[model samples]
Target: MTVETIDLDAAGVRALNRRLQGRDGPVAGGHFIVTNAKGRHALAVGLTEAMDVRIRGHVGYYCAGMNREADVTVEGNAGTGVAENLMSGTVRVTGDTSQSAGASGRGGLLVIEGSASARCGITMKGIDIVVGGSIGHMSAFMAQAGRLVVCGDAGAYLGDSIYEAEIFVRGRVESLGADCVEKDMGERAADGLQTLLERAGVAADAREFRRYGSARQLYNFRVDNAAAY
Candidate 1:
């Protein structure tokens, strides 16, 4: 496949984005490699095609945000809100990510090969995130749907104030949040967990992981549950 290289240092971010979005010229949808990212924010944000993009270096805030039907891979570390609000397709980070990674994403998959900072996957609506390393404090807070898989330890208050989101941790969890509680992983659930691991190319035994979800006690504001809230 032919690869087009875009230099972020010279073309400027707007020109690069316009070319990727196929706005000022040929319609997008091809393989592209971005060079000299230099920790730029919003690299490849709001992509709405089926193109493939690979960023060769570290990226700053909100890289690949609001993505749809595209495959984006960051060859280096990512800053805050990586792949946030992803609508479809895949966004992968081969290195660590900053806070709020994949926040409020509605669909698709996010694979993080390294650890993530605070509030990873917060408020995720339907996205599936697989982290090869640990996640920081308050990860998955208020997540409404989808799943979060942490291959390493999870920091304090995992899934705090969560809502109907499935969480699986292969390592120790510092603490469970308000409505988050561990539950028995049935046969079907274990099978699904295996599938996620396979999709993320993570090698781990599904039986070794623990599953957690909302206890459903805080769904309504009852007077007795007021203190918990």
Candidate 2:
């Protein structure tokens, strides 16, 4: 493996990426480790190959955007939109993540070791998001289809405007969103959350979680209930 240690600077990181992009063959699949970094944003963006990128410190907004098949890991807290529009593979944050962590993601797995801010999985399509800590309000908002597992407290207005997505919360929820309600924790959900928690390395029982999801009330608009709008 060709190891490259990059400093946590915008220009230095950009130059490294440019150099990596120009490389051919197995060089693209080697390990790219970042050290002594601090709150840098968009550290790895638009990388198409399957590589392992490890960031040793805190990261700012959009740490990995439009990733195709790379596995990126962050050792510290991350800002908003940590893995936006991910296509495949996994992006794991070993610390807390901010709002819109996996917004509009299409595929892959996003594991957060700590709490996530509001809209944790907004508009998510097929990604499986597992949060070891609590999540903020409006989580799973307009989520078309995906699985979101929250091991801690969930904020208000959870799963608002959701569509065909499964949400499992292990802690108290302030409120449920429109067209969203709690369902009986079936064996499928239980098994699913167990797998997710195991993958995220969260030490929690899946049975302890309470499930919440769409009630299918607002799938279509109704003029008679316009007052509720």
Candidate 3:
């Protein structure tokens, strides 16, 4: 496969997208290395094709946003909204990420090798997220579908107002959110968790994790359920 390198100082983020969008350069279906990323915002947004991308340094807000069919690896920390609204493929962060990472994503997998800040996976439609370290407060709020596997601890109000998303955490949870409660981890569920862990390359055993999901009591919002809100 072809390998191309882009220095953010030499070519701006927009210009780099232009070249990749052309699909006539090495970025079409090859590998890309972004050097001197220097927390550049929106480095690889709106990519519709498949490719292998490695960002050497930290990235600013919304890096790899709206991605489709691309495997992106961030070697450093990712700022807010990393992989937000991703449609397909995989996005991996070797370091921490800021708030709202993977928010509203519809498909694909998002793997965070380090901790994630607050409001991660908010309103997520159908994206799978695996975190290697702790996650901040109010994670998976209003999530509709997909699975989120946290190999570390989770902050308060995790999965608040969650719909159908399933969460598995290996560490202690500070608290649960509205209509979200712990579920019994059966053999089948453990199997699913194991599969997700393997895909994310996390070595932890699935049996160590606990599952959480919607209590189904807040769906109709009855008068008694008002307190749950």
Candidate 4:
């Protein structure tokens, strides 16, 4: 298949997004390459097609927010909220990302090859996130569902106020947040993690990681736990 190239400096983001979303006309599933993406915000937000898009440079906030069915890849670093609210498909970042990466994502796979800053995967509601490097403080705060796999160390307050979601960390965790506790990584869990790591193209042994999940302490509104509320 021929790869279509879109230059951000020449066409701009709005036009590029419109074409990718099929706003101009009927669009087919194909490969697209975006060049000269110099930290631009909202570069490819709200795309609903099943196209493969590769962004070649650093991008600003919300790089692929609300994406569905499209496979978006950022070859360089990403700013805050990368892949936020993604409903399906894959979003991969080859370099590091800033705060709130994959925040509120409902479904899909987010693969970050490098580290992520604070609040990565905050409020995630069923998306699978695999981070190859470390994550900063407050990662996965208020996560409702899905899985977060960190191949490297995690900073303070990991999985604070989590619910139902599972966190797998291969390296050290600085602290566990409210209602989050260490869970046993049984054989079944390890098997599942192995599949996820393969899907994310991460090379790591599932047995080397630890699992964490909600303690179910704050689920009921008991007056005794009012301080946590």
Candidate 5:
């Protein structure tokens, strides 16, 4: 396949995308290798089908937003919500990512080679996120189901108001959320983190990490905790 390189400022990029929609090329399943992208927002929005997109530089916001069955990889840092609402396939970031990476995603895997900011993987469902470095406060807040593996420390209020999701942190956690407690690191969790590390190409033992998740106490609203409500 002949890969096309589109060098554009933010406005030029949008114009090029609009022109692409008019062409007969397969917007859904076609492969797009984007380079020289200097933190442009909404890089690839609402793309469907089985596609492969490799971004060569940093992206500003909402890169690969609402992707479906598209394998997108960024070679640099991502601003925020790198893979929000991703349905399937994978989104891998080779460097650090900002806050809310992979927020409210349903399926697929998001791998960050470096650290992640606050609220990473918030309200996720069935998505697996693996971070090679530390995660900030409120990581995995209100997470429904899925797996989050952090190879480093997690900040305060980790897994606040979570439900059914599993979080593994290799370092210290400042505090656990309401009703959330530490559980014994079993074989299943270990194996899961190991598999994630292997998939993300991270070289670390899963046993080195500690696990945190929801207590299901805040799954529903209560009058006593009205401040949270």
Candidate 6:
């Protein structure tokens, strides 16, 4: 398939995105190739269509924030807030990502081929984050929904104040935040774990991962649960 190439600087990329969203959005719904990224910020923000976008190099903050239906693949590393507040679509980073990757995302899948920095998937709601490597401190803090799958070690204070979001870590956890406890991975969960691994294109034994979620003791504001606060 032939893809139209957008060889633009940071400002030009933003302008194209702006022009595309002028009326409902630009119908540039075919395949697109974005070259010369140069670690610029916000290269493809607020895209609301079913287009396949491939970025050739590193990108700065918010590379694919608030995306929908589009499949964005970055060939290099990404700065902070990659796919932040994403509603739908898939963003794959071939290299590592900075802090707050997929923060507050509602729906969609964010796949990090390498490690993610601090606060990865913080406050995630209904989105799925699959990290091929380790993640920094305070991941999934206050997560309300969705899933966070880590293939390597996790830093301190994971899932702090976590609410219902599932955590699957294949490596050792330095520490667990408040109200987070290890749970048994049943047959159904094992199947789902494999599915997520397949979706993210990472190879790992599902049995290697352990499940974690809310203890439900802090689900309500009870005096006894005050210690978790």
Top candidate, metric TM-score: 4
Q: Positional deviation of 102 in candidate 3, in angstroms?
A: 0.7
Please, what are the lDDT tens digits per residue for candidate 1 over residues 91-132? Answer: 999999999999999999999999999999999999999999
Predicted structure 4: lDDT: 0.95
Model 3 lDDT per residue over 1-229, tens place: 5688988899988887776555545455778898998998998888888888899999999998999998899999999999999999899999999999999999999999999999989888899999999999999999899888898899999999988899999999999999999999999999988998898898999999999999877756457766876
Q: CA lDDT of each candidate?
A: 0.93, 0.84, 0.90, 0.95, 0.82, 0.90
Off by over 4 Å in 3: 23-26, 219-229
**Tens digits of per-residue lDDT for model 6 on 55-153?**
999999998999988889999999999999989989999999999999999999999999999999999999999999999999999999999999998
Candidate 6: residue 66 lDDT (0-100)? 94
Alpha-carbon lDDT of model 6: 0.90
Candidate 4, residues 21-135, lDDT tens digits: the string is 9898765687999999999999888999898999999999999999999999999999999999989999999999999999999999999999999999999999999999999
How does model 3 fare in lDDT? Answer: 0.90
Provide the lDDT at 166 for model 6.
Answer: 95
Write model 5 residue lDDT over 146-205, tens digit each, in one string. Answer: 888988888889888888888888888999877667888899989978888898788999
Candidate 4, residue 5: how far the Cα is off, in Å: 0.6
Provide the TM-score for each candidate, comma-separated.
Answer: 0.94, 0.89, 0.93, 0.95, 0.87, 0.92
Clashing pairs in 1: none
What are the runs in model 4 whose C-alpha is more than 4 Å off?
219-229
Cα lDDT for residue 147, candidate 6: 94
Clashing pairs in 6: 20-26
Backbone clash total for model 6 is 1
Candidate 6: worst-modelled 10 consecutive residues by lDDT:
19-28
- When sorted by lDDT, best at the front, the candidate numbers are 4, 1, 3, 6, 2, 5
Total clashing pairs for each candidate: 0, 1, 0, 0, 0, 1
In model 2, what are the clashing residue pairs, if there are any?
A: 179-215
lDDT of 2: 0.84
